[model samples]
Target: MGADDKTQNNAEKLGGKVQEGLGKATGNKDMEAEGQKDQSKADLKNAGENIKDAFKGK
Candidate 1:
């Protein structure tokens, strides 16, 4: 994947982790779930980018 996309995805994943940690510390189930969802979305985007790169023989 391109550098910018990769960086953005990484940042998103990191932010999600922070959110999850905060939620756990504060006993907020909704925030934790949302954080997990954000991480999943970032992961999916990375997977899609990888697939595109593979198809392009990168």
Candidate 2:
């Protein structure tokens, strides 16, 4: 993936982590679930980028 996309995905993952921490601290199930979802989505995107990079021999 391009640098910008990678950066954005990383940022998203970090944000998700922070959100998850906050949710846990606040005892919010819904927020925790949402944060987990966000993290999963970012991970999926990063995996896709890794596959693309592998194909390109980067």
Candidate 3:
């Protein structure tokens, strides 16, 4: 994957983690769920990127 894509994915993951932490601390179920969703999306994106890279023989 490209460096920019990787960096953005990592940043998203980190932001999700922070959101999850804050949500838990504040007892907000919706925010926590949103954070979980965000993390899942980032994971999916990274997986897609990896598959693309593999197909490209990288």
Candidate 4:
């Protein structure tokens, strides 16, 4: 994946982690679920980029 894409994905994952932590600490199930969703989305995007790179023989 490109540097920018990787960085962005990492940031998203980190943000999600923070959100999840805060949600758990405050007992907010919705925020925790949202954070998990964000992390999942970032992971899916990163996986897509990896697949594209593989197809391109990078």
Off by over 4 Å in 2: none
Task: Show the colliding residue pairs in model 1.
Answer: none
Ranking by TM-score: 3, 2, 1, 4
lDDT of 2 by residue, 1-58 (tens): 3677888999999999989988999999888888899999999999988888889889
How many pairs of residues collide in each model? 0, 0, 0, 0
Candidate 2 — what's its lDDT?
0.89
How far out, in Å, is residue 8 in model 1?
A: 0.5
Which candidate has the top score in lDDT? 4
Model 3 over residues 1-58: C-alpha lDDT tens digits? 3667877998998899899989999999898888888888988888988888889889
lDDT of 4 by residue, 1-58 (tens): 3768978998999999999999999999999999999899899989988888888888
Q: How big is the positional error of residue 24 in model 1, measured in Å on the Cα after superposition?
A: 0.3
The C-alpha local distance difference test score for the whole of candidate 3 amounts to 0.87
Of 3 and 4, which scores higher on TM-score? 3
* Candidate 1 lDDT tens digits, 1-58: 3668978998999899989999999999999988898899899988988888889888
TM-score: model 4 vs. ground truth: 0.90
Worst 10 residues of 4 by lDDT: 1-10
